[model samples]
Target: MNFEYSDRSKALQEKLTAFMQEHIYPLERAYDDFVHANEWQVFPELERLKQLAKDAGLWNLFLPEEYGEFSEGLTNLEYAPLAAIMGKVYWASQVFNCSAPDTGNMEVLAKYGTPEQQDKWLKPLMNGEIRSGFMMTEPEVASSDATNIATSIVRDGDEYVINGRKWWTTGAMNPNTKVFIVMGKTDPNAARHVQQSMIIVPADAEGLKILRPLRVFGTHESPEGHAEIELDNVRVPASNLLVGEGAGFKIAQGRLGPGRIHHCMRLIGAAERALEMMCKRVTQRSTFGKDLSQYSSIRQEIAKSRCEIEQARLLTLAAADKIDRFGIKEAKDLIAMIKIVVPQMACTVVDRAIQIHGGLGVCQDTPLAMFWIYGRSIRIADGPDEVHMYQLGRNTIKSFN
Candidate 1:
């Protein structure tokens, strides 16, 4: 397949590159400091950057033509490289209103929301006026198998009351997160796939409580905090359900296909940045009066990293192309393949980059450690590698049958 960027994409790429250089890259340390000083609250600078991004016309690059009322209306193929640029600076995506949980949640609303639902949630989200979260993982279940989720959403009178605990609800810790697209079983007696449903719950509803923030790799908070939450009989009108009762699994299948590709694109970007840093570091510093870049091992790593990144980028683009040509369901194998490949590639590249930098790589002085964390986190975030591999294998075998 031809993966060439169109003139429109190229021009947008130029603008995005300039924007990152002029505004985002310079604020890396400032963003860190602001986050560290705040007591689990969003940094004020985020809003300021959001306004700048909105003014500069870089907002909502993830929204598709069908779903976007106030966005660039770019498809997954068009949006991949732009997302790659944002991945270089971890916080940059939020500035453009294209970050995760929000992106996934927005897509769900756009694809499945009623017109009224779109007006209430999608409009404010697209405008960057409100934030959202997705609560599906449970603290007790091996959440990799979403069917194992035990959260319950039961209808009572005209409303549904949700009861369960969710961890790794990524954006829930943010005080500004105004709503949650929560997944829970609405019909335990229905068929396995049809037992669940997705409901939009107001984050401030009486029974919704943010119990505490969950840490990753011993780090208590990553600038964007992941959280554990207790939804104790949270009530929302029956009209808040996305598709319909017993449609949760269907919605998740559709939502995760796009989300996985976005993660792959961003991971490829992270690997690209890590490789750039590796080459720069090894060339500038000499070990025992010889250039580090001159070493055969370093040269091998550099060559290998180049190949790996290119392969991962191609795989991601192919997945995007498949999604565009066929429906997301038809593109499942391509999506799963890239989801398994991209994160591992980024982690390996970042690890080598870290080795090249000596101790400095693991330190906060450079982004290698953070990049590594992001890639490593992906192994667990969107269903672990093993789970996706299992599905891919089963799908492959099914085709032969």
Candidate 2:
């Protein structure tokens, strides 16, 4: 199959790449300085970054054709490379309003929310005036199997009352996070897959509490931290229900296909950055009376990393191509395959980069430590590697059967 970037994609890629160099990279040092201070004070430069990306026509590139009202529209295949480019810097996606779980939440609103819901939530999100979080995981249940999500969305006259504790509610720490796409059981007795539903709850809704930001490795990722929360009878209008009751699973399936592809693509970018760092580092550093790059073992590691990164990129792009050509259901195998492969590949590449950097790699002097941890975290995020592998294996056997 043809893997060449289309003319449109090529032009956008050039523009986006230049924007990254001119606008985003300059803030890299400032970002590190803030992190070392132990609090992510709202970045004053953030609004400027957003404006620059928007003016350059690189905004909302993740909005697929199905969400045209929220975007002019680019298919998953066309957007994959741009996303990979953004993935090079951990915070670059926000500059273009393409970060998740906002992207995933916006897709749900565009595809499932009522007209009023879209006007209120989706519009602001698309316009970059607000941010959002997804509350699906629970501390008490195995959230990897979504059916175990125990938050209750009980109907009460003109509203739905939501009750449960949720952790990993991403973006909740951001003061601008104005809404949440919450998943909970609406009909516990319905067929297993259809028992749950999604509701859009205001961040300040009554009975909703942000318990704390959940740290990754040890850092709280301030300003846009992952949060643990309690929704004790939190209520929103019944109209906030997305698509009818018992449709959360269906919506999640549609949402996660795009999300997984984005994550894999970004992981590819992160791996690329790590490889770059490793190569540059080895050539400049000398050990045992010779250059590190001259060592056969270092050469082998570099070669191995290059091969794996290229392979992962192609696999990710292939998955994006499949999702665009076939529907998400038909592309599930490729989606699961890359979801499992990309992060592991990234983690290994970053780990080698870390080793190559010596003590500096494990410290704040470079981004290798953060990249290594993020790639490691991705193995457990979305769905764990084992979960996706199980699905892929079952699908393989079923196809043969």
Model 1: lowest-lDDT 10 consecutive positions = 64-73
Which stretches of candidate 1 lie above 4 Å from their native place? 68-71
TM-score of 2: 0.98
- Model 2 C-alpha lDDT per residue in residues 173-222, reported as the tens digit of each score: 88889999999999999999999999999999999999988899988777
Report the number of clashing residue pairs per model: 0, 0
What local lDDT score does residue 175 receive in model 2, on the 0 to 100 scale? Answer: 83
Give, for candidate 2, the lowest lDDT window spanning 10 residues: 33-42
- Residue 150 of model 1, lDDT score: 91
lDDT of 1 by residue, 83-146 (tens): 8988887667899998998999998888899999999999899888888999999989998998
RMSD for all candidates, in order, please: 1.3, 1.1
